[model samples]
Target: MENSLNSIFISLYAQRIQVLFAVIGVTITCLVLYCYRKRKPGICGNLRFSKVAYNSITVDWDRACYTTHYRVFLRKPLEGEKWRSFKTKNDTCSFTIKNLPINTNFVFSVCACNGTVQGPLCKESEVISTQNLAFKMKGISILREETLPNYIPVYDVPFRVERNGQLKVRKVTIGDYPKGGAHQVKSILFVSIPHSGHTTHLQGVMNFIFGVSTKDDFRLGFSSDITKKSDEYKNWATVYQFVEYEGGRLDKPLTLVDIPRMHGPKKEQLMMIHEQLKYILELYEQRLDCICFVGPANSNNLSPEEIDFLESIMYLFPNDQSSDLSTDISCFFTFADAGPACLENGLKSSSVKNFKSYFVNWSAFFRETNEFSDSFWNMNIKSLDNFFNHLNASKPKTLRLTLEGEPPAPQKKENVWKLQPEVKEDVANLQMTKTNGENFIDNKTKLTYNLQFFVYNGGNQTN
Candidate 1:
C-alpha cells in the first residue's frame, strides 16, 4: 500500500508541472498579440525648406498615413535655448513660420500625431536662417550692371606669372564697345601685398555679392586668355585684374619687366623701373577708371620702406604723369592701407590726399566648426559690401512706376516709363539675366534696366 501511494504522488506532481507550463505559454502568446495590435506608427520624412526670407521661412515634410496633424519645432542652434513649437493641419504638410529673428541660425524638426496618438519625431530636420537674403538679391542688380559694355575690361591684365618662374605675356588687341552706348563703364584695379590673403578675401567678397562661385558666375568668361589658362591665377583673375610683385620690396618703382630679378635693384635699376612703371600706368589709365591698393595684415608689419614704396607709387604714378595727355585720364584711388599684416596708425601720401583707405580686420573661416564667428566672416562680408557700394554709390531717386503686383492705379508724375505689372515674369526675367548676361549685345544689355540712377564715382570718363 505504501509503494502505490508514493507512485500516485509522483504522477500527480508531474501532471501539475505540465499544466503550469501550458498556461504560461498561452499567457505569453496572448500578451504578444495584444502588443502587436497597439504598435505606434513612424514619423514623417523629407523635411525641407520651401522658401526663406529676412523674417520668415517655409518648411515642409513628407506626409504620414496614420498622422492627423504635424508639429513643428524651431530654435536657434548657437544659442542653447528652448524650442518654439507650432502645429499644422493633417492635410497641410507645409508651414510658413513668420516673425523670426534676422541673421540668426535656426534648426527645425517635425512630429506626426494621429488624433490621440503621437509618433516619433522626424529623423532629419532643416537648418536655416533669414540672413544674406538681401545680399543675394542685391547681387542680381550688380550682375545687371556688369552686362553693360563699359563694365567689361577695356584692357587685359599685362602679364601672368607661371609656375616654372616664367612670365607669359602676349600682345592681344582688346577691342572697345560700340561707339554709342547708354551708360559709361568704370574700370578698377586691385593690387595687394604678398601673402596678405587680400586676393582670397576679395574673391570671397565678390562671390558673396554675386551669390556665385567662380565656376557658376557667367562673368568669369570675360577673364583674359592668360588668366583663364594660368593655374596660379585662374580664380583671382576672374573678377578683377590681379597684379603681383616678385621683388623683395616696393619702396622703389617697378614694372613687369623688372619682376624677373628677385634681388634688390640698385638706384639706376630703380630709375629704370620708375620710367617703365610710369609708361605702363599711362597705358593702363587710358582704359582703367580706378586702381585699388590693398595690403593685408601678415606676419610682418608694414615696413617704412614698403610704405615709402607704396606712397611713391600712389603719388608718382597717377599725379606725376604728363598733364597734357588727356583731361579725363586721372585714375581715382582707393586703398586698404592697413590690415593684420601692419598695425600702422594712419597713412599720409603726398600724392593722394583724398583717396579712401580702410583698416580691414583679420577674419578667417574655420572648417572644423563649419562657421565663422559673428565678428569674422560676416563682418568681412559687410565691410566689403559697404566698400563696393561706396565705390558705386548714387543717391536713390523716387520712381512713380509700380511693380507688377500693385494695383493699376497711376502714381505721381515722373520721367520713368509706365511699366507693365507682371511680378512673376519680371522676377524670373531678372534672375535669368543675372545668370547669363556676360555677352555684350550692341553695346547694351538685352535685359530690362529697372534702376534709373548710374553713378561713376571711381573714375572720369568724357564722351
Candidate 2:
C-alpha cells in the first residue's frame, strides 16, 4: 500500500511538471505577440516637402503600417493659429496643402491613422515659407535688365499646320489666367516612336499637372478639349497649356508639347516627319526646358527609325560637356507593369543602354496599365511628381533650332580676356572716371570705343 501511494505521488508530480511547461510556453508566445504589436504599428517617418509654390505645399512621407489614411497638419506657429488638419485618401502618402498665404511661414506635420485610432506623429516636421510675389517680381525685373533678350512671353504664339502643308505661327493669347497671373512658366516636349506608349505617358503627365485623373473633363485654357476623339489629327503634334492658381493668384503655368511618332516606312514619309519636327522647333525657337524620350518597357531594342530620331535630337541639342548638370535629355520607359524582370531585360538592350550613358539628365520607368484603379494611378502620379521636381531643380542647357540639312550652331566658347598691363590701367582709369563723373565721354562715343576695343582684341582672347 505504501509503494502504491509512492507511485501515485510520482505520477502526480510528472503531471504537474507537464502543466507548468505548457503554461510557460503560452506565456512566452503572449510576450512575443505583445512585443510585435508594440513595435509594428504607427511608425511613419521621413516627412519631406516635395514641392513648394506661392500658394501650395506638397508633402510626402514613407508609408506606415496599419494605416488606413494620413492626416496632415498645417499651422502658423509664429501667429499662434490653430492647427488646420487635412485628411488624405486611404493609403495615400502625399498631400498638397493649397491656398496658403504667400510669404508666410508655416509648419507641416503628418501622422498615420487607422480608422479612429491615430498613430504617432512623424519624428520631425518641416517649416516652409510660401513664395513671395514681390520678391519674384523683383527677380524678374533683374533678369529682364541683365539677361538675354530672348525671354519670350509664354504661350503668346501658337503653331499651326495649314491645309497646304505649311507651318504658320500666329499671335494668339492662349491658356488660363491664374488668379494673380503666373509668374513662372515651364515647357516640356515629348518625343517617341510609334507603339512606344508615348500617348499614355503624356496623358499621365497631364493628369498630374491638372490634378485630375479622368480625361473626360480634361480641358486646357477655354477650349482645346482633350476628351474628343481626333483620328484625323493623330499624326500631328499637340500642345497643351495649363495654369495653377491659389487665392485668385497664379501659382505656376505649364506647357506640354506632344510630338507625333517619328516613324516612316518610305523616304517621302520620312522627309515629311523631319519637316514637321523642324517647323515645331522653329516655332518654339528651340527653348524647351525638358525633352523626354518615351519608349515601351516591353521592347527589347529600339528600332532603326527610333535610333535615328534620338540621334537627330542629340545632334540638335548636344550635351554640354562643360557642366554635367545641364542636360535636358530625359528617358521614360512606359508600360512597365510587366514586372521587374521584364523591365530589367528591356533596359539591358544595346540601344537603350548606350543612350542612357549619354542622355542621363533624368530617367523614369513607370507602369501604365491604363487602369481605373486609384492605387495604380497614385503610384504613377508619385513617380511623375518626383520627375518634375528634379527637372525643376536642374537648369537645362539652351538649344538652337536647326533644319534637317543645316548643321547645329557651334557652342559658344566662353571668352577669357587677358588684358595687357597698359590696357588694364586704362580700363581702371576709365572705371574710376565714370564713377567720379569726370572725363566722361558721350554715351554713343563711349559705346563705340568699347565695341572697337573688344573687336580689336577679340583675336587675342582665349577660350
Best-performing candidate as measured by lDDT:
2
- Model 2 misses residue 267 by how many Å? 8.6
Writing each residue's lDDT as its tens digit, candidate 1 over 93-157 gives: 89999887544578888887766567788864656776442223332332323344323211112
RMSD of 2: 23.9
In terms of TM-score, how similar is model 1 to the real structure?
Answer: 0.32
For candidate 2, report its TM-score. Answer: 0.42
Misplaced by over 4 Å in model 1 are 1-186, 212-285, 298-301, 315-346, 349-353, 359-363, 366-372, 393-463
Across 129-221, the per-residue lDDT of candidate 2 in tens digits comes to 876543222222222122223221111112222232353221122333566543666767677766665644654454345343322211111
Candidate 2 pairs with clashing backbones: 179-248, 180-249, 180-250
Candidate 1 shows a clash count of 6
lDDT of model 1, residue 452: 21
- Residue 112 in candidate 2, Cα distance off native in Å: 36
Q: lDDT (CA) for every model shown?
A: 0.44, 0.55
Query: What would the TM-scores of all predictions be?
Result: 0.32, 0.42
Candidate 2 residue-wise lDDT at 23: 100
